[model samples]
Target: MKIAMVCLLSCCAAALCISRFAIPEAAAKGSHSHSLGYRCPMHPAVLQDGEGTCPICGMKLVPVTASGPASDGSLAVTPDQQKTLGIAVARVERAASSRMLRLPGRVTPDETRVYRINAGVEGSFRDVAAVTTGSHVRKDQVLGSYYAPAAVNTIQLFLLNTAGYDRAAKKKSEGSLDGENVDLISSNLQQRLIQFENLGVSKRQRNEMQRTRRIPDTIEVVSPVDGFVLARNASPGFKFERGMELFRIADLRRVWVTADVFPQDAPYVRAGMPALVVAPEESSTLSGRVAEALPQFDSQSRTLKLRIEVDNPGFVLRPDMFVDVQLSAELPEALTVPTDAIADTGLRRTVFVETAPGLFAPRNVETGFRNGDRVAIVRGLSQGERIATSGVFFLDSETRMKAPASGATASLTSSPDPTGRRTSGGGAGPFQKSSGDMQAEEAAAHTSAAALR
Candidate 1:
């Protein structure tokens, strides 16, 4: 009887131990199995309890792990995952900034240095040098000679006046002519000399005429300045009327480059701003400055015209030649970041800021000026903040997935229901799941809670 009592007690103790541990262990295992949920890796919006392919993207669904979202709606990504996604980060800082503007330009002669050769009287070229357009000529170099009938008459009148003045001076010296009469004759002679000089007679030629008291057959046409001929209308025995152009010359020691700047960039460009001109075909670079900004934009191209002056020592820069112009404008100190960091959604601009290691949050930003590769942050950001420079697209997509209420995420918060009425507050947004999907999510939520417990 003693042995039977001992055996029964042992059996009862063993049964109590099994009830306390084995039953709860089995229940917990069952709950964990029911708590598992599947989600598409690419399309996180697609969630379901059973494992299958995503209906939208056709990607294989993976089990959704029990990872909780951050309290501030920030998304946490692992270092390994960030590496796989190619995320790059940069720090925002205040510093001196500048922008480079590249524009097409054309080389032209300086307007102030261009000269047109014309005779003041009717004439015809008796003989012209073999010079044509682009021929170099020096100062006072004889380009051709012309015969003007008008010039001959003026010279004869000047000689007659000179004779009368001499006779008056002789009489005044002999005390026969009065001072007033001699002065009047001298004045008339001066007027005749002026008329003769106006007839294209140089000072040397006038002196020679006064000494010889005769008229030359032809007046020599000479270049007034050293330059290259831009146009030549003179030929042997070619007749030209008064005030007609014979040649066009330009001193090409300095040249102007006309650059067409976009209307939006016109504000930054001003006179005296430094610029660099490049000739691709010549493989040459020349420094220049903005000479002037045209008052109006082009009527056809709608671009503001800028005149840049540069020196051409070897005549390398020719008229009508195309070149590239680079203009640099200094910007005031402001918070700036790489241009790739900002994600523009048409309605708003957002940037993914790395709040902590492996954590990124979306921040709205007001952009001011956007230069190539960098942009100025006018507001909604501060210096010393780290932002994602590249792979922002993935962060943006994740932000929308994790935080639908984040205003700058650009995810719509409302959609029309079956009744054609729009509802606010996360009601079937672009990425939101349907009612049927909500049922699956509900089941997954229960499973997640069970797993957590």
Candidate 2:
């Protein structure tokens, strides 16, 4: 009887030990399962109260928290997860936004100051000038002389008409000729003078030819402007057709620098805006004003062209030379944030605002001008709010995954689209079920199991 009592006491102690450890383990497992729900990893929309195969993709479901979505349509992200994802954050503030554009430039001569010298009549150069290309010449300076049969014929006609006019005048003075005859002779003479002018004979040369009563063999070509010769095609004894180009002259007192500005930067660049041209070879920076903003962009580079007029006092800027250009603009002070902080979906632009520690909610915002690294916020946010800048795509993905949870408001709802139109966000997704229905289903299943037992 004593041994039986000892065995019974040992049995009671073992049962107490099993209850102490095994019961709590079972309870802990039940608590964990109750707090979590299951969904197909392949399809986050297929959420269920318990683990099961996905109806659509036929993939095994994974466990997710039943309370994943917060009341304010925010998603909770732990600090450890943020660190692992390399997420970075920044604050919104108010300041004057500015942008600086740097672009490659090329020097070009101003069209208004450039002149092309061409042969006035059919001729061969009798004598070429001593000056060559790059030589500076003064206005009215004789560049070369050319012999043309038209010029000789024109001068002869003028001399003949002058002689006829003189004879008619003398007869009128002697009362041998009528006034009508004298007037007719004078009109013919004026016609001959105009012909001489058309044949490249200057006023002084025409007058000399008439006074001397001689026809010159060659006509002198003179420069119309004081400038440097850009091109010289004159050669002695070389036959040339009328209106053929002989020389190109350009005044380099002012020049144009064509710079390529990107399309995004084109809006701020306008005529009369100040620009700076950097000549690395000359070791100087020249100030200029935007002469024109070209309407079209280059097909290959996709950049807009800007014409800048700069005064070249020492003729430092030359055609076809490359240089650097700087353009800048300042926008009015306003609320701004880093450009990367905003996530643009095709329909609307969103920003994740840090509502609480480790919690972020999406806010729809309207953006103004985008300056280099930052953008202006026109509406929907206040200054001094912190936002995720670096890991916005990851946050967006997390939000999308929790969007189908019933009674869990998703931040992607009821916001103004880019066009300032309000959109409704009151409807539930097709695959979503309310938490109450899921709870009722689980209670019914438990009752069925208890009755079977």
Candidate 3:
């Protein structure tokens, strides 16, 4: 009787333990078997019970399905979520086009064509003829004349020496002098004549002095070249020493257009490239070609100097005139994207690539020469890949908010419950919920409990 009673009590205890634990296990199994849902990371309000993305933010939502084998399958985002995320896409196309680099420059004078005239001798301020800066003069044109006592004395002495030489020559030729005297006199006169000729006494003047028996004291200075007088330093009566600069003349047929290019861009510019020069005060445009590239760089501006040669038949281009120069070079065809597509973060350059509808992944890219509105993609991308051209800023912000591995894990979590807390339910896992949603949920729950009570 004691054994039977003990066995019956043990069986009852066993039954009670099984009932207590088995009920909860069965309930948990049923709960885990239910399908899970997900919500968009960008738009927490959007919820999906299937495998898909959030319709609001276009981000894949966390799956409500349990993780275990018994748990419902993971949620797959529907196409509707893709449309909500404002996902933009572009198709890559291969096209042949040349990239152009433009650089700013200025107009200058050709060094070879410019000349400066200086006073050969001193004496001036008697009169002024070529007074203005831009006045044109010709070769041998008398710019002005001056009277110097030293010059006058030199001319008179030259005339006197010539007269003595002519008389001595006449006497010798007429055979009126002895052989020794003739030889000596002839040699002496020849030396004096050569000296006078070396002093710039023209042959015509010498002949006229011999014929008219007179010599002019005043000296007339003539221009050497046919060009516009760029500068004037001599006055009618102003006395100047030898070799002093009196005028400057330049040939305007050819001019130089100098441009300053950034050191980084200097490599692309070379001789023989086409350039356009536009004066600040004129509407006309001048065309020229790059003649040379200076080896030195401007320390102050950190720019390379480029010289271009142009024709100035109209004499419109002037020295010291500010001008605008356009230099262009052709680049080979390359893969390019809109400039706005790149997000420069100082350390790295990033771009958002749309892997799917409303689904973007941030990718680091290397960029190259940038044209006006487009930039060349040197690395990190292939042709035909969809890239965000416009609205990239917004996409970048959204991408930053998600975790680095969010693209893979976003569809597996649940939306957060009210009060920013995640509920232990089988619906979309609590996504990051805004304060407004939390407040609304709290108010609704409070009203529901009050009504039930």
Candidate 4:
């Protein structure tokens, strides 16, 4: 009897142990199991298991799988799956810097320094003394001579009258000895002399002609100032009228570079701003300050005209020559980034910001003025943030592929009903049961099982 009792105790202990372990195992069997895997967004051929990102794009790993098949025939992606893809990225930074803007412009003569020599009387061109267009001449230098018979005859007549009046004044003074008559004769002589001088006859020439009893035929055309001759219109026998331009001279010691800035940029350009001008054909650069900005906009080009004065003592800068102009101004300090780093999609501008290792999030940004290689960021970002500078398009494509398709149907399951008829659950058909009903059934099954135990 003792042996049989001991055996029964052992059997009871074994049964109890089996019941405890089997119940837990059976309960766990009803629960769903999942596997983890990672993939590269750019290269789908690369796959792995881990909590890391794609090697190519640095995008964080998405959950390997969930409960359904991916639209592209791959397993469903869970929140923890990591995908590696190749990509390029850059870090945002700040430093004291200046922007350089290059523009094409031309060199022009300063209006204040250029001189136009015009004809003073109607006559035929006799000779051109200053032969070349760029020849330098001093003030009062005889440029050319012209023969005007009408002017010459008028001067001769005036001189002859002056001589006769002088003789009459002397005789009146000697004979009358009357102060009033003598003063009248003297006044008449002075009037004739003034008339001759008004006709361009010099005082020295008048005295010599009066003593010699002769009048010069040709009139000398003199330069008004010391400058280089820009143009000459006289020939050996060219006829000229009064007020006709005969020559054009300009002072080359200073030149002007006229820049045609667009109306939109006119506000930025102001007088007294420093600018640099580069000749189109020469390597030398000239520096100057903005002298003035014309208020009116060009009717055809719609551009604002700005003048910059530069010294050209060597006479190297020529009028109408083309040049490159650079205008710079101090700008307010602000956040800036490479222009290539931002992705512009017409409607919106965005940049992919690095949140963590292999993790990036798209951020919309507002931009301001743009310099040569960089642009000012007005909003939506801060300094010292890592952003994808190059190859962002590939990452974007991968993100789209990983996202779930909208309006897609879920998978369905079939099971036997109490009446032996097959019923379907979790599908896109009209007969599909509501998700709430499924949850309720799962809850009831757990409760009933617990009560039975």
Candidate 5:
């Protein structure tokens, strides 16, 4: 009888102590913090004007009081996690911000400088011993020769005219070809010589043909620009028509650095923007300006074309050579933070703001000018706030995994999906099935054996 009585008295005493002291202290804490109502200390999302237990974890309500401005989605990190995740923080401040853009590009021939060498006249190719693909050619150097009927006729006519002119001049001591002192034969001879020169017959060659009185059948097609032979189409004895492409020449003294830019960044790129291009194998850097942004984009690469005109003084940059390009721009004054702080998704940008010691919360933000490691904050943040700069990605992922889902209401109803599939735990979980269902599906065949038996 005495043991039962003692046990009952002890239990009553313990209950009274908890109710009068511990509960009041917790209530006072909640009241002092919020100054209006009570809230759960562990889950601040649960708020009430009166004291109550947390709905998520059933923890006792603590008093909510003024703790300063902070994001509601703030989460606390333990010391171990901070070390493991390499979390780093910096204070947000106003400073001069500049934007430096880095782009990967390649050295390409300037469209205007890539000269397509075509046969000047129609004839068969001759003495093409030195002409070959990848040949370095000088200005006015013959690549190869080709035979064309009209070209042969012009050269032969030029030789005949010049030879006839010389003989006429010899006879012109007696007067003109028409036997007049006015000498209209000189004018006619000059016209014939100009026509022959229009056929790309050099003065020296014409002179040689005239002196030898030879009716040249084949003429040499020469390069107008000093460059490397990009392509060769002519071969000895091959009959090619006039205006046919015989060689493709490109001057490497200057080239174009075509940078591939994403469409989102296309607005800042414009003509005359200063740029620098550096090749991986080359020692010196080439400076240039944005010539133009090609209207068409590469279908497979889906990148906007930005052309930079670069001077290759020593022939250091070659066509198709990969290069790194940097473009810098200035921006208006604005609040900024480290670029590493921003968490980027395709549709939205977020940052982890340090609310309290070891507590970081995600805040949706708009970003502006980006320069190196710094990014301008257009919205959702203020100066004098602290933000997690490095390791924000890991912190964001950890917060989603560890923090309780806010505004989660309990629902037992099996929500139907678009396909009429029953989705438990309401329709807002994810766009996909839970892991439990996936596991059960994977194990369903093993359970079927019991039904068969």
Candidate 6:
């Protein structure tokens, strides 16, 4: 019995000696703890004491600085780690934005500038000009001339009446005029003038006849507008009635471009909005403005018809010419971020907002219209906050892996020694819960207490 007691005392003394001296030396000489070390949030096996990126998945190592309490699931990356991960950040900005709507359409002539030439009097074409479709014409330029007998007789009557009036005026000047005869001559002269004017003779032509005392073989007609010939019906010898159309001319200096706008984009298309037209034939772009939109919407196409009036200064745009149109509209000031920063995970849209220095939190944001490379944040984000613009995938992957693991064991208890050192006596730090316990908690939350006193 005494030998047994001695042996037990010897074993107790040896354990005390090792605990006081040898265990501490072994701990100091061996590998280090993870209290200040960093590891890959994706693969905890990839660990380092300083900033680094994981070789397996190329994810940045996150410092497990958990000597304190558990995290709220926000990822804290140091400046060195951010640089190693190639994370770039930008601040959310508030400014006026503009949206450009690109549409395809075609150009045609302005309807108001279109002119149709018609025959003024029944006559045969005698002197047609050297012209055809697409010929350029100027105002008051003669396109063709016709010879009619009535036009000749009409000129003769005017000349004879003017000669008679000259004789009657001479008699009055010599103090020998008959007053009744003078009124008769004046009435006849006015009637002859109307007949000549009705035959398409101008007053200037009449004055020329009176000066030269001779009439031309044919009366000429002129174009009323400076334009290009769109259609020509009359040939060198074609006969036509009084109201027959000879040519259709249109001023090509200005044109109208029409496009069909989708219903989603129709609200921004208002009258007077400026537009730019680009065509393959033109070396330069044409400037235009929205003239009007037709009242009738195309139900089958689900589109609204839009028209824009553009100035074809060089006559580069032509009827039936295809073109591309760009229309711009102003947008109200709103918080905006880079469009590439948003991550769509099928169920939610999220961005990495830097809640603190080198710390990013996954923010669920509602998005609005996208203007170029920027997107408007309709909700869940505020102005002046910085967010990750590049390297978002890494941040997303790291946060997702760490958040669930930390939450899985948050309810476990912890113990501390006399020296205030945490001892591994529980499942995990106070930031987790097992799956079954979590399920029970959620179920109890949905149940109701019917008999409350």
Rank order (by lDDT, best first): 1, 2, 6, 5, 4, 3
Runs in model 6 deviating more than 4 A are 1-85, 98-105, 120-127, 145-221, 237-243, 256-282, 285-314, 323-329, 345-348, 354-363, 395-453
Q: Against the true structure, candidate 5 has what lDDT? A: 0.65
**Which is better, 3 or 6, measured by TM-score?**
3
Across residues 333-386, which tens digit of lDDT does each residue of candidate 5 receive?
778888788888778888988888888888899988676678889899999999
The global C-alpha lDDT for each of the candidates, from Candidate 1 onward, is 0.72, 0.71, 0.59, 0.60, 0.65, 0.68
Candidate numbers, best TM-score first, in rank order: 1, 2, 5, 3, 4, 6
Q: By lDDT, who's the top model here?
A: 1
**Which stretches in model 5 have alpha-carbon errors above 4 Å?**
1-96, 147-149, 160-194, 292-296, 339-364, 381-453
The per-candidate count of clashes, in order, stands at 1, 0, 36, 19, 19, 6
TM-score of each: 0.70, 0.62, 0.59, 0.58, 0.60, 0.54
Error of 2 at 219 (Å): 1.4
Model 2 residue runs over 4 Å out of place are 1-31, 35-63, 71-73, 76-96, 130-135, 157-197, 202-214, 292-302, 332-334, 343-350, 356-359, 364-368, 378-453
Model 6's alpha-carbon lDDT is 0.68
TM-score of 3: 0.59
Identify the superior model by TM-score, candidate 1 or candidate 2: 1
Candidate 2, residues 1-453: lDDT per residue as tens digits?
645533433433322222222222344365435434555433555555455644433334445544445665575566766675556877888988667778899998899999987777888999988879889998878888888986766677778889999999999999999999999989999898777656666676677777888877788877778888999999899899988898899998899898988887776777898989999999999999998545467989898778999999888888888999998876779998887788898788889999888778988999988777888899988989988887776666555555544353232133222332211232223434566654544444344334322
How well does candidate 4 score on lDDT at residue 345? 76
Query: Which residue pairs collide in model 2, if any?
Result: none
Q: Which residue pairs show collisions in model 1?
A: 35-447
Span of ten consecutive residues with least summed lDDT in model 6? 444-453
Clashes of 4: 19
